[model samples]
Target: MTLFTELRRRKVFRVAAAYAVMAWLLLQVADILLDNFGAPEWVFKSFTVLLVLGFLPAVILAWVFDLTPGGLQRTPDAAPAETGVTADSGMAGREQLTNRVILVGALLIIVVMATERIWFAGRGNALDLPAAAPAAGLAEPDGPPAAADPARSIAVLAFEDLSPEGDQAYFAEGISEELLNLLARSEGFRVAARTSSFKFKGSDADIGEIGQALNVETVLEGSVRKAGDQVRITAQLIEVDSGFHIWSDTYDRRLENIFSVQDEIASAIVRALQLELDVGVETAGRTENVAAYDLYLRGRQLGREPSRAGLLRAIEHFEEALTLDPRFAAAYSGIAEAWVWLEDYGGVPSTEAYPKAEQAARRAIALDPQSAEAHAAMAFVRQRYYNDAVGAARSFERTLELNPNYVTAYNNYGDVLRDMGNLERMIEVHRKAVELDPLSVFMRTRLASKYIDVIRFDAARELLDEVLAEYPDNDYAKEELANLAVAQGRLADAIPEYRLVHFSRPGDPFSAAMIAIVATRLDDRALAGAWIEAARQQGENNRWELLARRPLVERDGDWAAMAELGRVTPGPEGALLRGTAAARAGDWLEARRLLLEALQLDGYDATQPARLSHMRTLTELAWVEQQLGLEDWEDRAAVVEAVVEELRRQGAGSIDENGVSPDYVMARLAAMRGDRAGTLAGLQAVWDARFLSHWFLATDPVLTPWREDPEFIALAEQVRAHAASERAKLAGLEVLP
Candidate 1:
C-alpha cells in the first residue's frame, strides 16, 4: 500500500495538525513582513498558493517519516521486498514524470521572480510615495522670521545613551536618532548633520567645548537601559555656551514603555529649547511594545546607510519580531522606511514598488496617527510627484513639531527654503546641521560653501578656518574655499587651495574648474587647458554637483566650451549654457530659444523674489526679446509689463531686469525700457529690503544692457551709496567724514 494511504488508514491527522500550525505561523510572520518591508501583494498572496501546493508533499514527507504502527515508509514503492523490484519498475516511469513537472514549475516561479527583479533593478526594490503631502497652511509659530536671518541659528548635538553597562545602547541610540530625525522633519531649526557627532562618540565633552566647536547654543543628551521587563531612561539639556545642564530626567517603566519614552524625551528637549509646536506635533503615532521597538531599532541600524542587502536583512529581523507579536506599528514604520531608501538609492523603480511602499506607509500611519516617518515618507512622494513646495513645507513643519532636534528635517527644510531664494537662511540651516553633527565633513563643507554663494565670505572663511584647523585634509572644503578666493579675484591666493584639494581628490571637478578659471586669470594657458580637459572627464553637475562650471562659463572664450559642458551636464544650467553658447556664436534666435526653454523648465524657481521678481529669468527673457530686434524703449516697457503682470498674479511684484528680487527685476526691466523713474523705484526697493551686492546686479549678466546706459549708470551709483547708507542704518556703521 502507498505511504499516503497507510497514513490515512492509521489516523495520522495529528501530524497534519502540527504541519498546519507551522504553516499558519509562517504565514502570519510573512503577512507582517510584507506590510512593513513593502512588497507587491502578490508576494504574500503567492505564499498561500505555495502553501496549498506544498500541502500534499508536506503530508507525504511527514507520513513517510512518521513512526507509525506499520513503521516508516522509505519511498512510494512500499511493496514487500519480494515484489519491490517489479513494483518499482512499473511506478518509476509515472513518478519521474511527476517529479519533472514539479521541478519545472518551481524553476518557472524562480525565473519570473528573477526577471521582475532585474527589470526593476534601476528603480530599487523598495516602494516610495510618488510625492510629498499637499501643503496645508499649518499655522506658523509666533513671530516666525521673514527670512533666514543670520542671527537665528540652532544645533542638535548627538544624545548620549547613559544606561548602566550600555545595555540600552541600541535603544538609547535609536531613540536619540529617531527624535532628532523627527525634529528634522521641519524647516524650523537649522540643525546639524549626523557625521558631526561621530567625533564625540565616547567623549563626555562639556557643552561649552562642544558649543565652541559647533557654534551653537543648545545641546541635548540622553540615555536608555532595561532590566528584565522594566526599562529606565535619563535625559538632560544643556545651554551650549553657558555649559549649564539646565534639566535632567529619569524614568522607570514596564517593557511596553516605548511610547512614553519617546514622548517624554521629545517633550523635554522641546521645552528646554523653548520652542513652540504646531497642532500636528501631538499627532506622533505612539507605540508601547518594547519587543517590537527593539526589533525596529535593529532594522533601522541596518537601513541608516540605505543599502539593498542591509534593507533585506532589516526586513528579516523585523519579520522575527512580527512572528512574536503580529500587530507591531513601529515594525511597520521600519519596513516603510526601508522601502523608501530602496526606492531612492537601492535601484528599485517606483512603478513596480511604490504600491508596496504606499501600503507600508499607510499601514504605519493607520496604526499610529502621529508617525513622523509616515508623514515624511508621504512628503518625499509629494516632492517626487508634484514638486509641491507649499505642501512639503507644511509636512516638514509637522515632522519637526513631533520631534524638535531632527537634523534631516533641518537639511530638507533648507532645501525648500533655497528653492524660494533664501540663500542666507539656507546657509544658516546647513550651519545648524553641521553643529548638531560636529564630525560630519560633508555638512561643514556644504554649509561653508553656501555662505560663499550669498557672498557671506567672512562667514565662509570663519567656518573653513574651523574645518581646516581640525581636519586640514578635507578636500571639498579646501577646494570650495579656493573657489571663494577666485571669486575675490585673488588668483595667487586661490592656487594653493586648488592644488591642495586636487592633490587629495585627484580629478575632482570643482578643483579642476576653479583651477582652470584661476589659471586662465593668471595667464597660465597650459594649466587652464589641462583643468578644462580634466573637468570634462571627472563628470560633475547637478543640484548637488556644482561642476566648477560657474567660473569657467563667466570667463571669455569659454562659451564654446559651454556647449560641450551643456552636452555633458544635467538640469537647468545645461540648458542655460547651450543658450549662452548660441548667443556667443551670434545665433540669438537659438540662444533665445534655449534660454526660453530653460525658463519654462525652471518655472517658479527661476524667478528671484527679493529683487521683486526681475531676476535671471526675466533678464534672460528680456535679452531674448531685445536681441530678436525689439530693442526700442516701448518694446522693452512692454516686456517688463508682461513680466510684472505675471508676478502680480502670483501675489508678488517685479524687481528689475535681473530678478534678484521681484521688485528689483521689475524696476530694472522698466528702466531698461527707458523708464528712469521705474529703474530708481526698483533699485530703491531692493536697497530698502537689504539685498546685498557682491553677489547680484554688478557681475550678473542679466543687466548687461542697463550697465551700458548712462541713465541706468547714474541710478546704479545712487543705489551703491544708498546701500552703504542702509548698511550703516542696520549695523550703526559710521560715515567717515
Candidate 2:
C-alpha cells in the first residue's frame, strides 16, 4: 500500500488535523485568559513552547495507540488481505465512535468560550474602567465605579469630510467634537474623551475595535459635506458588540442653522439611548455665524499642535473668529487655552501669557456663564499663574458641574491640588482624568511624575513602561523616566535618559538644561559647561538658561554673580534664589528683604522641584534671620517643621528631587537647636540615600560645627569621591559644545 494510504488507515492524518485545529483554538483562548489574568510574558512563552514541543509527541502517540469499545489496545498493523464483511463493519463502527468523541470535545470548547465571554463582560474586562470609584470633584466620594454604567458609554469619531475638495476636514472634526461635548454633558451618559476617540480618525479600524480601545459600548460616526451656503451631515450610532445600527439620520440645512442641527442631533441621540429629557444637552456657547465657526474650528485644531509657532497661529485664527463674532464664547475659551499652553509649553513668559489667558477666559465666561471650557481655562490661570488655590478650586468645581466629563478640568484641578500640598487628592483627580482619557500619553506621564515625586517608584516605572511600550519615541516619557531616576538618587542612570530626550528633541532647551544641572550636581563641570552652551545655542532666552547656571555659579562661590543672575530671573524662584545668594555673600539685610518678597509673591508650591525650591528658600531665610539675630527665624523654622510633618503624614517623608531633600532642612534645624544626635541621624539618612550635593555639603554654614567630626568628614568625602568617580566615567566623551 502507498505510504499516504497507510497513514490514512492508521488515522494519523485525522489526528494531525484535529491536533492543529485544537491547538489554534487553545492558543486563542490562552491568549485571552493570560492577558486578563495579567500573566507575565514568560508564562505565555513557556506555555507556547511546551505546546509546540508536544506536537510531535502527540502525533507519535496517535500512530502508536488506538481506542476500542471492549478494551485498551495498541493499534493493530493493517492486514494485507482483509476483504471480509466483518472487517468493513468493525472499521465503520470505530470510525463512528471517534467522530462522536471529536464532536463532544468541540461542543465543550464552544460552551466554555461562550461562558468566558459573558463572565469577562460582567467583570468589566472589556470596558477596562478603573476598579476604584473616582474621588475627583466630578464624582461622589467613594461612589460606585463608572464601569457600572459602561453600557451607556459612547465614542464620537471624527466625521469624514466628503466635501468635493476635501478641504472641510476641520469643519467635519468640529461638528463631531461639538456633538461629543453635548453628549458628554448629559447627566448619566459616559462619553470618551476627544483625544482617545479622535485617535481612530481616518483609521481602518472597525467599530468593535474602536469601541474596545476607547472602552465604550457605542460609536457615533458620520460624514460631512459642505458646498457654498449648504451643508449635508449624515450620522449613525452603532452598537459595538453587534455591529448594528442603533440609530441614523441625515440632515440638509443652511449653514446658518448648523447650531440647531447639532442640538437636534444631540437630542435624538439622547432619545435613542433612552436617557432622561432632564439630562439632555443645551446649545450654549455656540455661534450662528458660519464663517466665524469655521475660523474657531481651525483655531482649535491648530491649538492642539505641540509647537510654539502653531500656538501663535492658533491665536491669530481665534482672534479672527472673535472679530467676526464678538460674542463667540467658545472661540474666546479656545484663545485662553492657547495662551495658557504658550506659557506652560511654548516657552512664553508667564507674565506675558497669563494675563492674556485670564482676559480671554473672563470674556468667555462673561459671554456664556455656563461654558465649561471658559471655567476650566480660568481655573488653570488662577492656580498656575496667580497661585490662587481657592479661586482655582471653585472654578474647577463649577466647570465639572457644568460638564462632568471635562477631562482638562480634572487634570488641571489635580495640579491645583498638588500645589496646595494635597498629594492624595491630586492623585485622585489625576486618576479620574486618566479614566476619562486613558490613551493620552501626556496624562499618563504626568501622573507618573506625581508618583515619582511621592517616591512611589514601582508605580511610576510601571506607568512609564506602559507609555514607552506604545510610544517609544515620546520625549516626555523619557524625561519622566529620568526624573524617576533622579528622585531615586540614581544619578548615573538619569544622565542617559536626559540625553535621549535631548537627542530626540534637539531644538528643545529643556532637556539640555536638565543635563547641565545634573552634570553640575555630579561635579562634572566640564560636561556641565558643554551642555550649558548647548542649551544657550537652542536660541530661546527662556528660564532654563538661568536655572542651569545657578548651581555652577554657587559651586564657584561667586555669590555676587549668583545674586545678579537670580535678579534677572522671573517669579518667586528668582527672588528666593537671589535671596539665598545674597545671604551666602554676607548681605543678610538684602537677603532677608528679597526672601520676604519671594514669600509674598508666592506663599508655597507643594510640587517638585518647586517644593524643593520652597524648602530651600525657607531654610535659607531662617539661617539669614539667625545671622541678623531676628526672632522670626523661629517662625520660619516652625513652618519648615510643619511642612515636614505634613509630608510624613502623607507617607512621602523620603521625597527627594535632584539631590535636594527635606532631610537637609531637618539636619540644619537640628544643628541650630544644638541637638547633636538628631543632626547626625539626619545627616546619616541623607548620606544613605545619596541625596547630598558635594558643593552644598562642603559650603553649608550649619555643617561648619561638624567639620571636625570624623564621621561627618568621612560622609562628605565619600559623597565627593562618588561624584568624582561618576564624572570620571565620562571623562573623554565628547559633549554638546
Candidate 3:
C-alpha cells in the first residue's frame, strides 16, 4: 500500500486534523480568558508549548492503535494479501469513529466562536449593563435623526505599541493623548477626558459600548510602531453604533515629521466628523525638535499619575525637554503642572513650589500665549496656592475659551466657584464636567461630593454606589461614602469604611486622621489612639497639625507638645491649630490673639468665607467675644450672621440650608444668647442629622451650659446607642482595635 493510504488507514491523518481543530479552539479560549484575567503572556506561551509538545505523542498513539467494535487494538501485522474479513470490519469501524470525531469537533468550534461573539458583542466581560438600550440621553450614532444633534463627540483610546522591543508604550500613550488634546481644542467637538478614555486600554470592549459609557458617538483607536528614526502609525475612527469606519489612515514617516502626522490624524478626524474648522485654527504640535518633543511626551505621560514620585519624575523629564528646546511652551506647562501637583500632594511646601510653578506657567504663556495648558496651570496656582479667586476665575475662563472641551478647566473652575460660595454655579460647572467626561471616576466622585455638600444625599449616594459597583476598590468612592455616613449620624458605619480607606492607602495621612477623628466620636479610645499615632507617623505636610490635635482631643494636657507644634508649623492653618489648642486650655485671650493673627495672614483673607478654616476662625472669634462680654459681641455676632445668610442665599448649606447642617452654628449662636430652649433644639437637630462628633460635643466649652441639661444628656445617649447599633452590623468586617 502507498504511504498516504497506510497513514489514512491507521487514522493518523484524522487524529492530526481533529487535534489541530481542538488546539485552535483551546488556544482561542485560553487567549480570551488570560486577557480577561490579566494573566501574564507567558501563561499562554506555556500552554501553546505544551500543546505542541503533545502533538507528536498524539500522532504516534494514533499510528500505533486501531479501533474495533469492542475497544482499541494494535494495528495487525498481517500483510495485505493475508488480511481477513476481521481486518476489513475493523477498518470500517475506524472510519466511522474518525467521522464522528470530526463532526463533534466542528460543532464545538462553531459553538466556541458563537460564544465568543455573543460574550464580547457588547461591553465585553468588564461591564454588565443592559445591551439593548444606550445610557440615558445618549443615542447611538448610526446616522440621520441621531446625527442631527450636530455635536460630534469622540474618545481616543490609547494606542497599542507595536515596536519590536515592546518598550514604546509610553510613546504610544503620549501620541494618543496628544490626539485627544488636539481634538478637545477643536470647537464643536466634545472629547472624553484622558482618564475616561484610557480606562479602556487593552480592553476587548465593543466600540458601541465604549461610546455609550463615555456618552460619545465615535471612537479613535490605533497602533504605533517605532524603529530607529522611522515610525509607522495606523489609526481608525469608527462610528460607534454602526461599527463603521468613518476614517482610516497609516503614516510612515521620519521622527521629525511626527507633528505633521498628528496634524494629519486630527484633520482626518475633523473631516470625518464634518466639523467646520474655523479660520486660523492652529495645529496641535507646538515643537519641531524631535528630541525635546519625545522628552515632553514622557513628562506628560508621567504627570497623569497624581503622586509625589510621579510628579517629580515628570518634572525631571520636562526640565530635560526645556534644556533641549527652551522655547517649548508645552514642556514648560508640563513642568508647572508637575510642580503644582508636588505642592498639592504635600511633596513640597506651597511657598517653595507654587512660585516655581507660577514662573514656569508664565514662561509657557510667554512662549505660546494661546496655550490652554499654560492658562490652566496658572489658574490652579492662583486658586489653590495664591487663593486669588478673581485671577483664578479669569485664567480658568481664558483656558476654556482657548480649549472649549478642556474638562479639567471646568472641574477646577467648579472648585473655584465653590470656594467663592457660588454653590449653584459650582454645581452647574461640575455638571458640565460630568457631561464632558461621563465615564471618569474622578469627575463622577467630584460631582458626588458636591451633591453631598448640598445635602443631596440620595443623589450623592446613587453616584457613589455606581462608582463602587464599577470600581469596587476605589478608595475615593469609599472615603466619600464614609463622609456621608458621618454626615448622616451613622458613626459606626463610617468607621469600617474609613478603615478600608486607611488600609488601602496607608500613605494618605488624611484617611488615617479621619479614622482617628471618627473613632473619638464612637468612644473607641484605643482605636482612636492607634490611628492618631498612625497619622502622626505617616503624615507628611499636615503631621504637626494632626499631632497637636490629638492631645486636645484626648484632653491629655500636653501643652508643651502644642507649643512645640506652634513653633514648627507655619502658615494660617498652623495658626488656627495653635489657637484651637489655647482655647482648649482655657486661655481665651491668647486664643483670640492667635486667631486674629491667623485671620490677618495672606492665606486666610484670600480664602473664601465658605471655607472650613474661615468658618472655624469666625466661630471661635464669636465664642471668645461672648466669653469676654465685650460691647462688640453684637458686632461679632452680626458678622457671623451675615456670612451665614450669604451662604444660605448662595444655596451653599446642608440639610438645614447652611451646609452639612447649621445645627452646630445655631447651637453656638443660641449659647451666646443663653437661650436654653433654642440651644437644646439646635443640639437635637444636630443629633437627628447624624453629625455625631461626640468628643467635640462633650469637650467644647461653648456647649458647657447644655452639658448639665437632662434633655441634652438623653440625646447624647441616643447618639451613642445609634453608633453602637451601626457597629453591630459590621460582624465580619475588620474594625479598629
Candidate 4:
C-alpha cells in the first residue's frame, strides 16, 4: 500500500490534525490567561516550548498505535482476523473514525474562532462606548463634560522597571510620561493628567477601575529593562473595560534609538485605537542625547514634589540637562517650571524667581515655540508674579492650543480667572481640570475651592469630604473644609478643622495663623496667643508674618505696628490690611483711600458684583465713609446697598458675605440713621451668625449709641456665652485646639 494510504488506515493523519488544532486552541487560551494574570513573558515562552515538545511525541504515538475492536495494538502486529473484522470492514471502520475525528476537530476550530470573534467584538464595542456621565449634581451646568469620547481617551500608567537592579524606575517613568505627553498633544486624543495616572504607579488596582477613576477608555502600560546602552521596552494597549489587549509589542534597541521606540509605540497605539494621526505632528521626545533626556526626566520627577528643597534639586537637574543640550526646549521648560515652584514654595522671592522663570520659558519658546510646557510656564509666571492678566490669558490659550489635555494649564488658567474675578470661567476651567485628573487630590481640591467661590457650599463640602475620606492626611482639603466652615459662620466647626491642620503642619505659618484667628474668635485668648507665638518663632518676620499678626491686629488695637508692616506688603491682601489698620487708628480719610485701592487691586467693579471679595470691600468702604461724616455717607451707602442687593439676588443669601459679616456695617448704618429697631435687629443677626466678639460690642465706637440698651446688652451676653461654650469644647480635644 502507498504510505499515505497506510497512514490513513492507521488514523495517523486524523490524530495529527486533531493534535494541531488542539495545540493551537490550548496556546490561545494560555496566552490570554497568562497575560491577564500578569505572568512574565518567560511563562509564555515556556508554554510554547512545551507545545513544541508535545507535538513530536503525539505524532510518534499516532504512528505506533491502531484502533481495534478487542484492544489497541501496534500497527505491525494488528491483523484483520484478530480484530474480528475483514480488511474491508476494518478499513471502513477506520475511515469512519477518521471522518468523525476530523469533523469534531473542525467543529472545535470553528468554536474557538467564534469565541475569539465574540471577545474581540465586545472589546471593540467597549472602546467605542460613550463615557459614563459624572455623578448627578457633581458637574456644573456650564462646565465641560465630565468625560471625553472613550475612543479617543487614554491614560498612560507609569512603566515598571525590569532592569537587573530594578534601579531604572525613573527612566521607565520618564518614558511613560513622554508617551503620555505625545498622546496628549495628538489631535482628538484626551489623555489623563500625569498626577492622576501616576497615582496608580505601584497600585495593584484593576485596570477597569483605574480607567473609570481617570475617565479614560484605554490604558497603555509597559515595562522597561535597561542595561548599559541596550534597552528593551514592552508596551501593551488595553481596552480598559474588558481588560483585553488591543495590541502589544516589545522593542529591543540601543539607547540612542529610544526616541524611535517611543514613536513606534505611539504609532502602534494610534493604530490600535483606530485614530488618525495628523501629518507632520511632532512626538514628545525632544532631545536626541540620552544623557540630557535622562537628566530632564529626573528633573521632572523631582519637580512633582512642591517643596523648596525638591524644587531646588529639580532646578539643579534641569540646569545640568541644559548644560548637556542647550537647545533642548524641554529642559529649559523644566527649569522654568522648577523656578515657578521655587517662588511658590518660598525658596526664592517672586521678584527674583519670576524674571528668571520668564527668561527660561521665553528661551524654550524661542527654541521650540510649539511646546505646551513653555507656554504654560510663561502663563504661570505672568499670572502669579507679573499679574499681567491679559498676557497670561493669551499664553494659557496658546498652551491649550498646543496640548488640549494639559491639565496643569487648565488648572493654572482657572486660577487666573479666579484672580480676575471671573467665577464662571474659573469654575468651568477647574471642572475641566478635575475631569482630566479625577484621581488627583490637588485638582479636586482646587475645583472644590472654585465651587465655594460660587457659593455652591454643598457641592464643595461633598467634594472635600470625598477627598478627605480617601486621603485623610491631605492638608489642603482639610484647610478648604475649614475655610468653608468659616465662610458659613460655623467658627466652632472651623476651629477644630484648622487645629487638625495646624497640628499636622506645626511649622506652617499659615496653618498656625488660621488657628490663631479661629481661637481668638472663639474667645480662647491663651490658645490664640500660643499659636501666635508659634507662628512668630517659625519665621514670622518674613513675608508670611502678616498672617500671624493679623489676629492680634483685629483683636487688639495694634494699628500702628500693622500699618508699618503693611508698608512692605504688596497685593490686595496687603492693601486690605493697611486699610483695616488705618480704619482702626481713626484715620477715616486714609482708610477710605486705602480701602478703595484695595478694591481696585482685587478687580472689583460695580459691573462684576459677583466677586467674592466685592461685597466685603464695599461694606468696609461704607463703614469708613460713615466715619467720615453722615452728610457724605448717602452716596457710599447707596452703592453698598445696590451691590448687596445684587449679590443677594445672585443667590448669596448669607448675611455674612465672603467673610465680611454685614452686622457691623448694618449696625453702623442704622446708628447713623437713628433707627433703634434696625440697630437692635442687626446686632441680633450678628449674634446669631457668631460674628460679634464681646470686646467689639462693648467698646466699638459705632455701637456707642446702643451700649446702654437692655436688649443690646442681652445680645452681647448671648454672644459671649456661645463663645465660652465653644472654647470649652475645643479645650477638651487632645490636640490643644
Q: What would you estimate as the lDDT of candidate 1?
A: 0.56
**What TM-score does each of the candidates earn?**
0.47, 0.75, 0.71, 0.75
What's the best-to-worst order under lDDT? 2, 4, 3, 1
Q: On a 0 to 100 scale, what is the lDDT of residue 629 in model 3?
A: 70
RMSD of each: 24.6, 16.9, 14.7, 8.5
Screening candidate 2 with a backbone cut-off below 3 angstroms (N, C-alpha, C), the clashing residue pairs are: none
Report the C-alpha lDDT of model 3 over 75-186, residue by residue, as the tens digit.
7654777423345676677777878988888888888678745643432221121111211222222422212223378899999998999999999999998888877877
Query: Least accurate stretch of 10 residues (summed lDDT) in model 2?
Result: 132-141
lDDT of each: 0.56, 0.76, 0.73, 0.73
Stretch of 10 with least lDDT, candidate 3? 126-135
Tell me the lDDT of candidate 3: 0.73
lDDT of 2 by residue, 636-721 (tens): 88878877767656755345333456777799998887787788888887777667777776777777788788878887888888
Candidate 3 local lDDT, residue 574: 60
Clashes of each: 73, 0, 4, 0
Alpha carbon deviation, residue 19, candidate 4 (Å): 11
For model 2 the local lDDT of residue 406 reads 87
Per-residue C-alpha lDDT of model 1 across residues 615-724, encoded as one tens digit per residue: 35446556566667765434434555665554545433222211245566566566556666676677666655444242244544545556767765665665456434
Worst 10 residues of 4 by lDDT: 131-140
